[model samples]
Target: MRILILGGTGEASALVRGLAGSGHAVTLSLAGRTAAPKPEAVPTRIGGFGGPEGLARYLTENGVDRLVDATHPFAARISRNAAEAAAMAGVPLLAIRRPPWERQAADAWREVGSVPEAVAALGEAPLRAFLTVGRQELAAFAAAPQ
Candidate 1:
């Protein structure tokens, strides 16, 4: 089967490696946001496909049998585009979602809807806070009192 994998995260890379020698033609797509992305196991294509229409066109033109959306969980636009493109192209789509972090008894977790909310939740008091957000979003938390 010919597979197109929308990838960037570690999970995506692992999927590519797992698919190696599986007798399927696999192509991995990267967003091109990273200055130096790790080399992938499968054939790779960098940058966006315009939008859903363009992605659908690529799927049809390349005769892509399946689409695996393995993009970062925070990439909503690409995920939406992939879903729309799969529907438009009449191709089967599968998403490899990241499992949510499990809270342990010793863990102090504060869930917030957005980065701003997280910053707001930090309060005005100066405190040592360890943020686990991606580097791209670090700017949002810069104003937090920490």
Candidate 2:
């Protein structure tokens, strides 16, 4: 069976390595957000499939038997596109969703709607903040006085 994995995260890379020599033909797809992405064990494709329609077309044309969504949690658009495309192409789809971080007794967490909201939660005071929203969203926190 031919498998297409929508990948970018470390989990995706690990999955590709694990599937090596598994008999199934596997291909990993990256969104091309990084200038230089790490090589994968399986065949790799870069950039978007345009959207749901384009992805469906590619799945049909390439004869993909299965689809795996290993994209980042914040990549809502791509995830939706993958689901829609998988349905349209009549291909089986699987999602690798990571479990949420478990909070410890000493951990203090505040949930916010967006990056700006997260920044605003810091208040007007100049405080050191550690941003972990990913490389693409780093610029959004630049205006924060922290």
lDDT of 1 at 144: 79
lDDT by residue (tens digit), candidate 1, 38-109: 987788999999999999999999999999999988898999999999999999999999898888998888
Tens-place lDDT per residue, model 2, 1-146, is 99999999988999999898999999999999989999778889999999999999999999999999999988999999999999999999999999978879986788798888997898888977766587778887777777
> In model 1, which range of ten residues has the least summed lDDT?
127-136
Taken over the whole model, the C-alpha lDDT of each candidate is 0.92, 0.91
The residue pairs that clash in candidate 1, if any, are: none
Q: After superposition on all CA atoms, what RMSD does each candidate show versus the true structure? A: 1.6, 1.3
Off by over 4 Å in 2: none
Residue 134, model 1: lDDT of 70
Q: Which ten residues in a row are the worst by lDDT in model 2?
A: 127-136
